[model samples]
Target: MKPVDSPERTKNRTRSGRRGGESTTRTDILTAARHLFGENGFTKTSMRSIATEAGVDVALVSYHFGSKRGLFTAVMEVPGDPISRVTAAASGPRSDLGRRLITTFTSIWENDDMGVALQAMLRSAVNDDGAAKAFGDFASGEMMPALAKTAGLSQETVRAIGSCVFGLALMRYLIRAESFTSLTVDELVDQFGPKIQAIVDQGR
Candidate 1:
């Protein structure tokens, strides 16, 4: 007869599997949320739909994210926290602020899988008042203040800089304008860096 497995070994194996599966389950929910939100926009996509897409019970979605708004916030938060990244980049030497900001922003879009979710949020903001308000509030309340504090600029100036950078990214990546898309990241940065720097200089 085969030897019986030890109770302690079985217990440890069960705990490990449970921990691993919980992480996997959370990841699945997030992946499903991103895809659905990207395709359907915020108003059209429901928590139940996300649950269905993730193949988890609807209650689990609530357990993980609290609500749809909470989930949307989590989705919009790119890995490494885009706001913190920008603040850190701006915290460097004042002379290099433009180059740093542009370089960091471009690198983020190029390296991360956030483009789709960003596009979705932009689209939703355009069409939905609620989404527009939420997006604007987040930018004004959270991002602009942090960036302005670090960069030593007025919130208005930082907001304008953010708009310019966002427009560039939208044209280059989301809209895929041929001319913008054709340029390398360095080339685009070189071209835009002066304009951004000019704005940063004004804040001094």
Candidate 2:
């Protein structure tokens, strides 16, 4: 007859094996957290849910990311050459600049993976001030400056141009304004890019 296993011994074996087999590290935690937060907005996702999704303990999630907000901030930050892509697309042929700009932005927004990251950030921005600041920093630090430089516009003029673009993005994307939705990309360019171009052309 085999010796009876002690309850405490079995518990220890299970716990040790659990960590040994499936311990989640920082990168794993971040990946899991981003997925949950992306699918279910910031407020809806929880540490426990992230751990469950990651197949780790909730404590591990806290240990790695510090808190939900930290994880969220991390999730919002996507690494890319934002300036390079936009400037490259916007650089040549001033006559086609407007079309190029609109098309490039639309293409970025439509890309599935990038779209999830952007939507996650946008959702966070809708509810959190810190997220909004991060979004602004990313745009102002990289995207706006690069775009303005590409267009050869001054700081003040860039601000005006950014405002118009922001207004268009908000109405068309976030708000889904009926008037703006259902319009083709070319139609949007024809209607709005000229207005943006006028500001860029003035540069005051």
Candidate 3:
């Protein structure tokens, strides 16, 4: 006959199993959310569908992310906060701020995985009002104000500067325009940095 297991051993085993399962569950949900969000855009992808794709209970998605918007936020978070990175690039010598911003922005797009994720966010923003609003609010409310404070520029002026940078990124990454896409990051920076600088310098 086999000896009975101790209560403490059984409890430890159960706790370990739960911890492992929780981590796997969260990862699976995020993976499913990213795939669905990319394929169907934010408006169309439902929590139930993501759960189905992840082979998880729908409640798990709710438990993990709270809601679809929360899940999207999680998906979009990069290693270094993109907004903070941009703000940092915009800070310091006003003379070189434009070049710094362009270089930093382009480097982010050149990051293979991050570029794909950002592209998805942009695509969803185009066709979904909610997504568009969220993106706009982030730019206008968070990034614009931070950049304006850093560059010592008026909010409106900073907004225009942001528009130019985002437009360049949109054309190059999302539209995949032949002319824009063909240029190397350095070349694009060389070509557009001055234009951005012009906008930025006006405020100084």
Q: Give per-residue CA lDDT, model 2, range 1-204, as digits (tens).
A: 999989999988777753443334666777887666556656567899988887888998787767776675566754345567778876887666666676776666667777566666676777876566556655666677787778665779778866876677677777889998788877887887777667666664
Question: For model 3, how does the per-residue alpha-carbon lDDT over 80-179 read when each residue is reduced to its tens digit?
Answer: 4665787789778988877888888888888998877778878877887656765676566667878888778898788788788888878988888998
Maximum-lDDT candidate: 3
TM-score top scorer: 3
How would the candidate models be sorted by TM-score, starting from the highest? 3, 1, 2
Residue 67's lDDT in candidate 3: 77
Taking every candidate in turn, the Cα RMSD to the unseen true structure, in Å, is 8.7, 8.1, 7.9
CA-lDDT, candidates in order: 0.78, 0.70, 0.79
For model 1, how does the per-residue alpha-carbon lDDT over 62-99 read when each residue is reduced to its tens digit? 99888776776787654445566768888988888888
The regions of model 3 sitting more than 4 angstroms off are 1-72, 75-79
**TM-score of decoy 2:** 0.61
- Give the worst 10-residue stretch by lDDT in candidate 2: 17-26
Measured against the true structure, the TM-scores of the candidates, in listed sequence, are 0.63, 0.61, 0.65
User: Which ten residues in a row are the worst by lDDT in model 1?
Assistant: 75-84
